[model samples]
Target: MTPVQPRTRLLFPLRRRATALAAVLLTACGDSSTGTGQPKSTLDQAVQAMGGAEALQAVTNEVVEASGSRQSPEQGSSISTPRHLSNFRYIRTDELDGDKLHIEHDHVTTYLSPERYQFTEVVNGASGFVDGKDTVFTPAQTSGMFTSRATAELGHTRLTSPLRVLRKALANPAIVQEEQDLEVDQHRFKVLVFREEGEPELRLLIDPETFLPAAARVLEDQPPLGDTVVEAWFSDYRDVSGVKYPYHLRITLDGVEAHAEDRERIMVNVSVPAQSYEVPASFQPPAQPVVPALADFGKRSTQLLQGLKYLTQTFFYFDQSGLPITLNELAPGVVHVVGPSHHSLLVEMKDYLVLVDTPLFYPERSEATLAAIKAKYPGKPIRYVIASHFHSDHIGGIRHFVADGGVTVLAGEPSVPFYQRAFSNPHTLVPDRLARNPVPVTVEGVKTLKVLDDGVHSVEAHRIQSIHSNDMVIVYLPKEKVLFVADLFNPNLFPSNQPAPYVWGVASGGLYDEIQRLGLDVERIAGGHGSGTGTMEVLRITGAR
Candidate 1:
């Protein structure tokens, strides 16, 4: 049995800040120093304002129903319009005493096409599950990884709940609380900082007039943005069973609104069956896949899950190790680097190599790919990396190339500034290769077409117009009669018998139009995703013309 990969958006743990504490405790009683000379800890005041410690601690279970939208900053159609899931519905139940949490999410996404997604995630103690069938915990040998991930997710949810945080502060004496005065949007706030052992510090801002928690924030490391503040603002308080609950909630990343929700209802001490958190007796989770040593990059392979549409069995565990670099030759000098979920193309030039896309979120995967490229093509350095678009999955590993030294990145004109700013942001929270050994990032903007000819090999990078993304760039290899693109068309995903107006028909049609407009000869199509290269017949079969 192979372990199923949890939904990409479902299992990401928030990055923690690694910096030392900076703010000092403003007096033991908290930072309310006025001429009146009042002495009271800020945490105590916040707890009392939310119906006191006794009422909050007595509550053992909570159920919240909310609706909102989820945004993917890197996958947006343009700089101003990001890819988002609208009409989002969320239901979360927490058994505080049992240290359990369950979440149900449903939403509709309208980017290149319209699709609906629904999934359930549950974390009980050290074990977790997805869709009640796939285990999220690895084997005992790698138990620490699961523990840290589950703990971070559980801690984040608790911090967002005013009642839970207050109960935690009252129960743990070792936890330290400090106070500071800060102003945002011309409004003064009394910020209470809570620090716990082996956990990220949380800062909760209090409204001076109402004494209620205005918002809670924590510093975290998110690549591209680097060290950023994630905040959850609470408002529209309503009383339910002698306890105050915030009906309206808004979340922001670096002061930009990312999510907003309105609670339809809130229940305390709800009767939840214990079996909800238990794993089925018949189910056994597979062991974690071990990463192969650098020397065995091309020799080792393992089975792992892939794709976001796992429920329909459209995706399943396959024999493809995301750790080992697999290169498939499409032409003489063109190689397609394939992975379970994403793919990249490497083009060998006269003196240097040009990698089509850096596909993968984490830096380690990119590092592995880079190592393999160096091994295959010994002395030739990767001089230029062409970004297909601004999506995270396509450009997440751009920093690794920059760290390779003297590498230039070519992107659509509108996305050049975004990459420039993202590359310059501080990565102190989780330092990658670029952060450890600092180097300047060079980005060139391509408005329409940029050609690179080494006298022997000629590659044309063209900015194409598409509904999927305005910044999409497709690489054309005239000599080899091959084209490289991302998202616009995935041959493996489209069925030959399927009708017109395919899920990706609009974007694929746009790609076809672009090829014809440029009057370039294209025989094969390579993608930033899928397993193999496709032919022009794939487009014609899908009625892309």
Candidate 2:
């Protein structure tokens, strides 16, 4: 197979203006006061600004009604243009005593097609439920017995509310300290740092004159962009029931806008219904075993590929754990590289190997898989790496393969520019192989279908339309009569007897329609995720539903 070079230059210079500006700001705002005097005084002033400590203590519950838009940076069709969920209406209710939160979210997303998603999430103490059903927590979230994924997310959400932050800090004064001041857009902000146990360090920026929280900043460890700064800016403060609340909130990830909201109503000490936090009687918990506690909390393990612990708090769907990598032979030349959560398939060609979907959230998994492939295959090199889609989990390790020297990436036509831009971005925070050894990457776009035939074996790459993503690609092996896909249908999750879940039914139905359109003989089906490969019968049963 001949590699197709990009029409334009692929390797562009990395942009460092933001990094330079941040460094200059940090230098200018060096710590001036170290003692507890500044922190205590600032806390007192902030409490007075927010209707005094009495008012804050009297608040037991809060209800906020807002409208906004949220961006899925990882699930975008392209790295540059993330999947945007606009026209979002949210009703969030919080019970401060038990650290309980219930949120109802309604939004519409348009990538290839317009689809509407409406769901309710609840977190009560140690248990979490979604739409009144028990939900599975990621390995990182279930690492500790005292804390769960839901509670961690609740804390992150509460950071946007200054009242909640002040209450928590006041309750534990030892954790609050005065940090260096910050200057942004000619405005200086007094920074109050909170170092809590088993939580990410939060830097709350306060307005010097108004003493209200101007913004909240925390460092989150995200793949492709490590140690990313997540900031939430607050504005338009309004007083309600003797308490001050911010009506406008804008959240940013690494200086890029992620979510923006404007409050329509705010209520304090509101009555919360019991059913909001209750799990349904028919709800069945996942059979997966509980994850063990880490040696150090909130720190990444150097020995293991387990992702950063705080990722669960930042990203709701983030889940990376240390699972043993196992290889299974599916066909005479096809091998399945299975990880704890995600999986990858390797197809042997005439001279080299073709890998389908580098499935994981980090390069470590890809690196490990590469080592395993080299060990098993001996001298064969990976010539082509096919990306199932532009989702972060599936493509996070693609850059690693590019750094391996002679691998051409195959992606959907719409995602070609996205891969180019993502490959050029500076990975200074945690330099991976690609960052350390810069190299030009060749990304070939598959408009509808692209076939690789080498007499002995042939692999076909086809772009399919799905509600899950616009840039969806599935691989077909006609000689073996096997189809490889991602996200569309996971047979293990949705068995042949069982019907596809709510939104998943739409995605699987689209896949079924595309299969019928192509008129290819498909016998076995493999997924980028899940445990085992399924049959065409399973796809028919689930997709037909």
Candidate 3:
């Protein structure tokens, strides 16, 4: 798998520019002691911003009932189908006990405990007892419990709520205004802006009438998957206790939509004993760990002598924007490599080229990579596209490329038919450009086939066994002694000097077995994501020697 885009670090800028600007502005507007037209101080504003102490204290528990779907741009299996949807309900109960507060959730929940000083989790199905003092769970299910809790907290928020919407803006520190005028819900109100670490800043669009957030926008340095903006809309505000909460929330991540809900009822002042957050007796975590094989390759079908350039690929993710973008690159000439989700390679054989993987549907990087490839190698035209697998990031840009008259697409045999059926369906997740001009594909079969027989630098192709995907192919260059493969390996960890097998290739030993079976001479190897080039010693370290 390709490495996720690194989160941009905004600490220095925040401390240097944002904080200084806020301080300077505060100082300039000071001495308005009467509090007449002046905005409240930061502390006072923080208190008032949260609806005052009375409102905050009014609610003790919140149970919400909602049903929605979770769609992953990484998930290509559910494209044009309802299978992408996962219906669920969420419940959260925050019990304040004196200075210590214990929060619990009916579903899997992630939170920072009162006593532990660290975050913990409570999984659903299995019962957990929490003492109003410190929340605890059985050691057996610790991983699952904590994962559930954290996922709930983060996933539960609707991008639409006033608080959440504002929180999104405040995530950035660039904007200094306490409030600025913005329009939302057919009304004009003062919205706040702040700069966060990376690409874009956070914006809070509040309702002028109630000071509630009607919507929020996050800005990133790059655009979203489709080279568009991202926005979260918070709606269905209902007062739970004294706190106003938006029941329905919709988030357009680069353009993909995700939703969540709170079910049951909101509880206020319903005190609980300090011993409820304790470990349950029935909890038992299994002693054995489930380690997935990463390097399992089945067989060799074909090789692309030219497709080995992009073997070492790295991706960076830019989010919280209207159109979040992820960036990565492919080695030149190494065309048509496939992997699982977000793990694919598309190399344009000619001087000017196009890459298939835009980083898990983060199109900004994809576009950048294309432009960079073209700019770096002047006079080359990227007129061909290929997918390594059926996952979203691998093939999401097919329409974009195809619309540009890119010809001669190559993909897994299984993928060709799947795409043929998908191209004709309603394109709700993304637009369908493959339907415009049927993409010509050279699906790999049982035997190996060479794409180009250039005597000086020939490209070889092969079909390999991959546990991650059934119809996967690998490209090789006999002359260059380089291999362009996907999902089977990542060369990035080479610089870190990490141990062999690297979790990915070792997990799927089939690739190693096939390499040995075919007995192809290879000195260097590249991957679809992560590291691009590395010596064969990396795989040999995992017992292949």
Candidate 4:
């Protein structure tokens, strides 16, 4: 497809001048302001100034080819350095016609780890399909809590696009308002706000002098991240066939940069194939990817990887977001990392640090927790890691401790084998601290109960079998009178108004009985899945025998 040549005389009177003189020129239209006779609507002038509604309607297929560096931080898997981002090359192509659309994206990164990711989506009318070669994504996967999400979203996007969004706002004069008096990052702009009940509220900011679009903002809402402000800035305006288009684009989520790209060329109204938007007849929806179990780690299937990333996303909103670690002082030298939905304990002893139950989606959680502990405690080296159980979720990042130095890992019967397998599993896709820095996984298997004390502080790993698993272990701190348990005493899953399920993972009175049988002083009860509460309070409320 050939780009439309710009009307040199009318559109380029100012000729995209040098830096200083460029500030005085207007790129969009003839000129209109308060001093002008009839105040031409900013949006109308903007639409016409950029080659009008017809130029936009002419675009059936578009290809944007650019070369720039993309940030790739294998987020939750790193230990020593979390902020490291590798550069990558990428290409994106999009096609649209009536109610059909197709999108293809390819990205390859060669850095601390070498990998390739490709994603393609096609939507024809009400049908849609998405597939990609992602190491963390498995085949036959469906997205949604209880329904399909990709199909619904892609189908809607097919009928609506940036041009369509702009057209809809212009078609409804009542929803469009010429507004101004808005300030963002200390820069004031004249804006046209478009408000529709069911559609997104969009605000288009224009340069006061040129009346050209400077930025656009959309208000999007969700449950987890709440109402988010998505904004994009347009810069380096260039004439592609008589039409003015932005060469540089930057999109930000909340306030963090999500994408930054420099467009080398954009070809519109290109030839598109019929199969581009057609969904195959033999498509079978795969269930949503979930964080995998320990066994899934070695398989390196897409399902397991998607699950791993999704699990981490469930706790931390975005991969680039900072670690959310809030330390609750359980007692002197004993701290509970309460920020993660999946918690961890940082125990400081006279000679070393003992972290019990490194939980959450992946290595990033453990790495963050380890950093927080060392930052606060400073010189104490972590010598022992008390892995409470074998459940993969309870100890996803146990290897971070091992990678730090010579750390002895303790798990109960049956779980130690899992520890060995997890420690030695293949991690070529998403390598972690232990994977990058080879270290011997020192782990101890406890049969019934095990105890370790260095005169100042003490910890005991007890194998307390429950309906949840035959090899569960509970951690106990004697001097602090605080007892830590995993699935056996998770208060978060407690039934409201109903009896303790006493079924499967939901614990029973056996935990209470065990506490009494051991004659352990347990005033405060901490957990791997629930809020730490008083031992008597949990027993009284849950009626734990």
Candidate 5:
């Protein structure tokens, strides 16, 4: 699976100063005078804050049990809810020079032990493999990736386990310190913030009376969300045979929260079996489809024009080979782009050709489409490329075609600044798209544009005031009575019976109203990412009164 980039938004001004203030505090703490002269010192304070060194060192086995609820909202205020349960185990090992640790967390065994090691995850049946180095044990399920490398500074001693959070703080005294109190659930806790430059602040809330941690909060390093925090609550401390355990751990990200239970039976000391850290012999990776190089780019091109086409008349589909390999081609010179994810269209113009959307980002697909266009239209040049929106998928390939001298057009409002910033500096993500061809971009207005140089191909770059995106545009061929649009309606079946109004609801239905309102006389519509080509009745199916 592709790694999702971290959603990091930093509020600049105050955050910059706060970062500097945190640095000064950490630097001051490094002074020998900063240490509390109580026989134990800061290192001992951390160990006592947890259970103790001997108690922590005695921990041989640990188990965690947890449960949580999840939900995803769909169109029309609909939602899907899923609940899950998990169990976790950790054991010390002499495998990697005795410092190695092995972790097996079941819900189906997601996270692994040892700081910088490879691990696999199976969460709610979704499986993924990760290979990276780390200082602390990593969780299998995460809300998002950390934008900075601050996690590398995290010591095992900072974690809530026997000798866990203390071990690192003892070795690095500047890592943890006490802070002001914060009240929650009518109880006050002494908040102590951990410092690691350039990283979000990690705050541990300790119960004032017991000095036991009540919760852990990591504030976003950036300002606006500087106070925006993710927290994990630890509770139900139980000590067995000198080893301490927190029976319950609840994590909250943004507003969502999940809880897990710790080991039912804690083992203080036992000989762990060998081969525990080894990858399971029965482990198997999920089967992934072989993607054709250029085909992925072709899929991306189709996704840009979704809100335009609705229930289909003659929709087109492509096979896996990415061959323009027709899944089902219904007519000549008109193609509906249909894939598993988005929508699109293919228009064979008089001389060169016009493509409606470019949704996916595949190096080979862009090349393949250009190659196919060349082969299909022997001497014609692909003079124009239309983008329906500014979404990454829709406009990802604009620079590719623009490099080829193809005049790229977008919805005037947002597209101007978008393309300007996007292509201001030469695009480097994928070079081949614009390698041999470099073209200028044209921003189309909220009106009609007709190109009669080669054929009667009209461009109706209208505004789609829809929830999908603001800068949405569509291409139209009045002479052919075919309109190319994206994200409007996805025709799963040719001549889809689903009403356009019901398909896109108020937003796209308003767009359908604009079609008739503008008097384009469209008869056939090709969608942005899915199968296109729709009859006049299909358009009327969602028309406004």
Candidate 6:
């Protein structure tokens, strides 16, 4: 038997970027320090306060470890819910090895700067398969490595390692502003702001008395999201080998408190291994599908899933060797538009036409399917669309029907809430029919049965208690002795190598049950995923492999 696959959303393990760690750590720029400046300028004062440029530049290596709960971007309606909030801890080791700023993270990833050395995953116990080996993992592309590298440079330089930030500032002498007015903690103060081309806009609130950094703020683009704010407050100043640093740190995002870190010890002039940040040779990413990068896992996974929907539509829409959409005339005023993956039945009525279960895998497929339906029956519009269920594959192209003004979605009562969420959510990224042309989410929900008859043909939708999708809507045609079911029945039944989980296997779980109970005549079983016409007798007697 074919493997009973899990839901599409739970198939792949969703990945995470710095997320909680990314924004929180950039704020802890080693507390505040006092120093002398002839002009007492913002840059000079901050430089002196941070143990002087000579003291910071004189340092070699550093390391830090932090633990926090990361919010999952996928949970809430408006986003911002941690996927698994278990308070996972992580140890991050940073080093400047041979003109390269290197970093190793736990549960995250590693990076080697200057010339990005790539590694899908490099941790000793981490998991990833790359280059046909389990030891060292690498993605098909090495862009993630560069992303990690840039993040590390900003984090380590600004927070724990001050020299890197100072180095960049000195390199670009005009990047820092002298004096600016700012209010913090209900007090007015003079501030020094650092601006860069692509990097986050940094601001350092200065204490006029000691010329030390009171707090820091960074405005960064967390992909797929607009620029977000990251702020850090440093306190508990202590001297570490003649260099003062903040032992206590507080970080926040968008004015909401995120997380904090308390330093156990601050160690400078540490020894880093020769192979500490070693990575695989440079990789040249081959041209491939354009995948989107987002601020959080929610958007990334959503985008990827949507991308798969489009890909599925394209593959079936342009199958060169596959069968063309055959228009089967089962009876007068009754036809089925059969395609490679699925089929749709068209029943012409007196004034309008009724289309059963639009196999809307993609907008492309919908366009093709709707076009064929339109071509077959010239003038009449598909006034009512019977959506079998709320499966992604079945619903991806649902917008096509909604765009046809006054098209009512006839669904089961169980699927009303789902259709509501689907219709209301913002599709700003990829505007569809509902997004472009707004419409009231109209669904003629079938509590027990909903009959759409126009004097000539009648399309009856009966709610079935199917094992596959509990809220299954079986579209029955009494005159033609034909029925259209969504996932409950696969008209293209195959002989499996092993026994199927159900008595009927992948054919139909509750189809015969509903048919026998209702005593309706079902000669031909038309399916949403039917390859061609199927008979109910052959379906049951085929027997489980």
Best by lDDT: 2
- How do the residues 1-545 of candidate 5 rate in per-residue lDDT, one tens digit apiece? 11111122331112221111222111123221335642333334445656676565555444333333221111111111112212333322222112233433222211111122222221111111122321122333322111111121121212334234444455466887865456555565555677755333467666645556677665321100112234567778777666455667665433344334354554545565654433322232224222233222222222111101011100111222254423234356656555444445566666666666654443444545556556656776655566676654454445555555645454436444444534443332234444334334454434334342345344445555554555566666666677767666544332345443333544446667767777778777766644546655665554322
Candidate 4 lDDT over residue span 1-545, tens digit each: 11111111211012222122223223344455335556566776677656676776565566656654433112212111122222333343455444455555455543223445565545443345556643322443422221122323332232223444456555667887865345566566667787765344577777666556777765432111112355667788776665666777765544545446687887777777777666565442333332223222212222223222222221122221145888989999888877545677778888888888776444556667778887998888888888766544667567666776678887776655556655655444456676677667577877888888888888887877564456667888888888887655655556523335423123546677667787877888877766755464565456445
Reference-based TM-score of each model = 0.82, 0.66, 0.43, 0.45, 0.47, 0.49
For candidate 3, write residues 517-538 as lDDT tens digits: 7788988776665544655666
In the range 120-178, model 2's lDDT, one tens digit per residue, is 66666544545421122222122212223454446556568788778888788998987
Scored by lDDT, model 3 comes in at 0.41
> Relative to the true structure, how large is the alpha-carbon lDDT of every model?
0.67, 0.68, 0.41, 0.55, 0.43, 0.51
TM-score comparison, 2 vs 4, better candidate: 2
Worst 10 residues of 1 by lDDT: 298-307
Pairs that collide in candidate 2 are none
Error of 2 at 483 (Å): 1.9
What lDDT does model 1 reach?
A: 0.67
Give the best candidate by TM-score.
Answer: 1
lDDT tens digits by residue: candidate 1, 136-252: 111111111133334444655765787777677788845746555666666767777777654567778887666789988776655544555777899999887777889998876
* Model 5: residue 199 alpha-carbon error in angstroms: 19
Give per-residue lDDT, candidate 6, residue 74.
18
Minimal lDDT window, size 10, model 6: 108-117
How does candidate 6 fare on TM-score? 0.49
Clashes counted in candidate 4 amount to 17
Candidate 4, residue 450: the lDDT equals 82
TM-score, predicted candidate 1 vs. hidden true structure: 0.82
User: Each candidate: how many clashes?
Assistant: 2, 0, 99, 17, 56, 7
Better of 1 and 3 by TM-score: 1
